[model samples]
Target: MTQEPKGILIVDDDQDMRELLERRLRRWDLDVVSAENGVDALEVLEREGIQLMITDWMMPEMDGLELCRAIRSRAFSRYIYIILLTGKAERHELVEGIEAGADDFIVKPFKKEELHVRIRAGMRMIQFERQKETAIQALRKKNLELEQAGATIRAHLEAAGKLQQAMLPLDVEHLGGVHFESLFVPCEYVAGDMFNYFELSDTKIAFFLLDVAGHGVPAAMQSVTISKVMNPLTLRARKAPTESSGEVKTRLLNFQDPAELAASLNRMFMGPKTGTQYFTMIYGVIDTEKNRVQFVQAGHPSLILLKSDGELKAIGEGGYPIGLLPKATYFAIELDVAPGDRIFIHSDGITDCRDANRKSFGFERLHEILSAKRQCSMRETLETIHRELISWTESATLEDDLSIVAMEFK
Candidate 1:
């Protein structure tokens, strides 16, 4: 269906002039309406929704200038273009008409061609305004939709963050005779860093801290997958053939050696499907009965050992990041730990964390803090480290995922 052209209203005190203008406008195929005075013209405008008007400047009761002022004062749904037909041609008269809100003017005995061109200009302005209004409405609708989508994504990310937090160690602070404490912070709602500690046997316990490459959803998902794979129950589900029976049997093979656990993880994750994804990890097992700490470092930061005699040692020489090399070999280091000795394992996010000056909170600072807090309990020491890190960066939020696990021999 085609939309009808807008009607034009003509107001004049001269009956003959009104009819003559109407005839000429109708001959040009314009939808024209006429009134003998401004008061009646207002009624026609309200009733017919006319957007263009032509009026004689002088009249009884009310005139063209008064009509323009009245229309400008009212809050109409659309803009109204007013053209004044005036006998006065002085500059001051034109300025007075403009101040009264007339959009254009035509002098006495005006040419019909000039009148038609002025009407066309008014129609073009109305069309432009309509197009601009439509574009604004469309942009508002799109902005509303984007806001809704952004809200949904944030909700999902928050739920995923809660699930990841639940996977961390619970209230098992004291397992066997060793006390444990930890801290975890992610740059986003979900973290690429993960850590956990669980008992392997009555006298043996396992713990690990791994940081997947990158941040956000992809890295967080991979971290969660690796955490599931590290579960003792899942590890035990993988059976191997026994040499004596030549039959498949469930064994805690990976749990016995931290190096083998790292190697198994590398083999499981290495492939084109994983792309350039890899992770740095420190996997360790503590034997309560033997008072020994055995661990494997796969491209992770060195483990800090604060001895009972107040001596500090930084262990590990760095190894290949897991899943990066098919033939990468991991070696486990065994150390004798005495009562009151403490071991700290962390992701590189800690030492690599930068301050406002772009200076890293390096190994020297970390070692100094550990030595100074030697007399504090495991939890206190970890808390102190966390506070210092936040202060050093001068921000409540970190640039990368930060994770730390501390253990004290009893």
Candidate 2:
């Protein structure tokens, strides 16, 4: 269907001129309206919604210049292009007309073709203004939709962050006569790092810390999945029954070895079904009665051990990261711990943290901090590390997820 042409208004005190212009414009397939003076012209314009106007320079009540000024001062739903009909030929007169808001002008005794060209020019300006308004409206609508989508995504991320935080170890500081302390920070609302320490038996305590390959939702989801599967019930050794005095009794064996646990996780996550995601982890078990610490490092940072006498040691030879290869092998290393010795397991986010100068807070600095804080309590030491890390990076947030789990023998 064709759109209707916008109406044009002709204003003049001369009836003959108004009638003649209307007839000519109608003959050219244009919608036209006419009035004898500026007052009547404004009434016709308001009633007809005309967007183009041609007015005589002089009239009894309101002249063309006065009408132009009035129209420009008032706000309308759309733009109106005005052309003045004037006999004045002086440059100053033309400038005055333009300053009064006339868009174009045609002298008296004008050729019909010149009049037609002026009308066409006015129509083109109106059309361009309409197009610009339409585009601006469309852009505003798109911006509103994007803002709504962003709000929804932010809400979901905040909820997920709370859930991830709930999965962390709580009040496990004195579990099985061993003291535990930790720190966790994420660059975004959700994190890819997880840690927990739980009692597997009366005398055995298990702890683990793992960092997924990246940050944000995908990595956070995978880290949550790993945390659930690494719980004591899933990773604990199977129970067996024995006959004692003809009575059947069941006893708990040792928890799953750290190496076997890593292997199992690798097998579960490696393959085409699991995508290309992988993670570094340190999983350990401490026997309180024997003062023995056994752990596996799956391509994770080495564990830091601070002895009671203030001697420091870095343990573990890095192994393959879990889920990277189908046949990757992991082995557990065992060490004897003395009373008051502290073991630290952390993600690489700490040592790899950088400052404005692009210098990494490497392992050497971490060792120095641990050695300097040896006299402090386990909780104080972990808090000191957290403060130092933030100070080193000189940022409220880090570039990656940061996590650390520290345990001290009783």
Candidate 3:
């Protein structure tokens, strides 16, 4: 469909001059509207989609200067490019016309070709204005759509965070004769770190702490899947017994040996099909009957042992992280703990934590805290550790996910 011709308004006190200008513009495919003075020009402006104007300097009611000023005062959806036609050749008069908002000017007795060129230039400017306005409107619409999409994504992330929190063990309880306590803080709404321990049977309990390789939703989702696989009840439910009359089959999974559990998990997680993601973990089993804790380390921070006699020891030979190598093997460290002995397992986020000075809360500081809090209960020790980290960082917010599990053998 062809667009309607652009309308041009011509204002002059001389009717013959106005008609001559209007006829010239109409021949060039412009829709012409004529007015005798500034007052009449304003009425035509209000009634028509006039995009350009030509007006004489001297008019009976209002001059060209007044007409330009009045046109500028009123708001229009499109620009009305104005070219003042006048015999006023003084620099002051030209400046006055410009100050009144005349976009351009032509001298009286102007050549017809020059007038047509000036009019074409004015029309080009009006077309440019229309294009700019359309682009601005399009940009505003796109911005609104992006804002709505962002809001929807935020809501989904909030829902996922709530679900992750609900899966956590809000209050740590004793399993067998060992008392467990924990603290978990994620830098984001969802965390890449997770830890849980539960009773496997009347005389046995199992626990694990893991940190996924990265932060945000991908790591959090992976951590949740791994946590579910490590859950004691879930693991037990997956086990099956062979068919035999009145046969009591031993559990194929060696939950008593942390190295065996690590190997199993490595096999479960390692495959070509698995994406590029891995985690560091400390998996352990506490035999309440034997009074021993056996655990394996997989590229995680060392486990801290606070003995009843105020002795602090770090356990574990740093092994490769799980899911990285298909044939990765793990080694277990077995410790005999009498009553009152405590074991602390944590993610790298705690030891690698940075202070305001960019210094890490290294192993030395960790050892000092453990020795100082050796006489304190498990819960009290955890509180002290948490407090010290916050004080050192000078902020409650951590840059990474921090998780700790303190188990006291009783």
Candidate 4:
């Protein structure tokens, strides 16, 4: 590729000096332009693409020092390299010329070779400045592109968060004579924790809380898929209204069993076809007429039962996490409770929560809260627990998804 030569401007009151410098520099392949004085130099500078200038210190209208300072005051697209020519040998005078923005200086009767070498060095500096400016512009453009991409990602995350929230059951619900309240919090835009409760029949209601193994979009996506399959309407539709009476009765009974449901979900989510993600869950069914609850806990934190007498106990065997083993076994645990008793099911996001000092909010603290708030309304108890957890962490954001469901039998 052919490289375009740079422009060099020479300004001097002496016509001979201007012509000499112009001819010498032009031989070196630079485009040369000359002016008789600083005033004419400024005019030519305005009209030409000048990159380097050699100006005499003394002139009729404007001197080299004044011209250099004037050029420095105005912002230009490219840096201008200026060399001042003067007979003054005083150190202070040289310092003064440099402070006026002169890049270099040459004597009045300078050697041709020395002037050529100095001009060559100045041209290199101009080239370097142009390259630096180009690089800076490129960097700014890249930064702007990255910022735009970040904004786009944030918008998608917000939308995903809204969808995740819609997957949850209402904040408060009532089934038969039992009252339910819940709290959910995710550290990020979406979470791996999910919970829902729905009527299985006139005599039974079912609920579950599950936590996928990780946080963020991958885990949240898995939770969403599971929620859809486990939805009450979807499960009920599987049996169909057209089924024989015996088949419908048996299918509804199977749906009300926690062990059968947990094992089925584990199988659906297991194997290589499901990838390397797994979750812990607790599924339960309440019999309003019999006043009994049947539940299964699969590698999840213990479920808390607060008796009407203000006694709290943790139930269930800490079984293997669902999807961890294809042949994993789960057992149904039944609790026949008196009226006014309450039950609490939660994901490990609560027990595993840490404070600023890295202290875990263990099951002991949870039990104490439940026992103390036994007489409180379901909403009050849930809110108190949520507030305490936030205070312990000292921040609104959590390291994982926080989910809890509490139900009080009336």
In Å, residue 212's CA in model 3 sits off its true spot by 1.4
Per-residue CA lDDT of model 1 for 266-367, tens digit only, reads 766775645647999999999999999899999999988999999999999998899898779999999999999999999888899999999999999999
Give TM-scores for every candidate, taking all chains together and pairing residue i with residue i.
0.83, 0.83, 0.82, 0.85
Question: Which candidate gets the maximum TM-score versus the true structure?
Answer: 4
Residue pairs that clash (backbone atoms under 3 angstroms), model 2:
none
| Per-residue alpha-carbon lDDT of candidate 4 for residues 1-410, written as tens digits (9 for 90 to 100) | 22333788888889888778878887887788888888888888877778889899999888989999899988776688999999997999999999999999998778988998888788778878777877898999999999999899989999999989988999988888878888888878999999998898898999899999998999999989888878886785543121245452224325777897777777667846469488999999999999999999999998889888888889976987887887788899999888889899998877889999999999988888887877778778878888888898998777888899988888
| Cα lDDT computed for each candidate against the true fold | 0.87, 0.86, 0.84, 0.85
Count of backbone clashes, every candidate in sequence: 0, 0, 0, 0
Candidate rank order under TM-score: 4, 2, 1, 3
Instruction: Give the Å shift of residue 321 in candidate 2.
Output: 1.0
Flag regions of model 3 displaced more than 4 Å.
Answer: 1-5, 36-48, 55-77, 89-100, 237-253, 308-310, 355-359, 365-397
Question: Considering every candidate listed, which one attains the maximal lDDT?
Answer: 1
Alpha-carbon runs more than 4 Å astray in model 1:
1-5, 9-20, 33-50, 53-109, 238-253, 271-273
Off by over 4 Å in 4: 1-5, 35-49, 58-70, 86-100, 105-109, 237-254
Q: Write the per-residue lDDT of candidate 2 for residues 1-410, one digit (tens) a residue.
A: 22334588889999999898988899888988888888898887777778899999999899999999988988888788999998987999999999999999999989899988888888778888888888888899999999999999999999999989988987347888888988888889999999999987898889999999989999999999888777666654444343469785755433448887787777667746568479999999898889999999999999989999999999998999988987799899999998899999999998999989999999999999899989887778777877888899888888989889988888
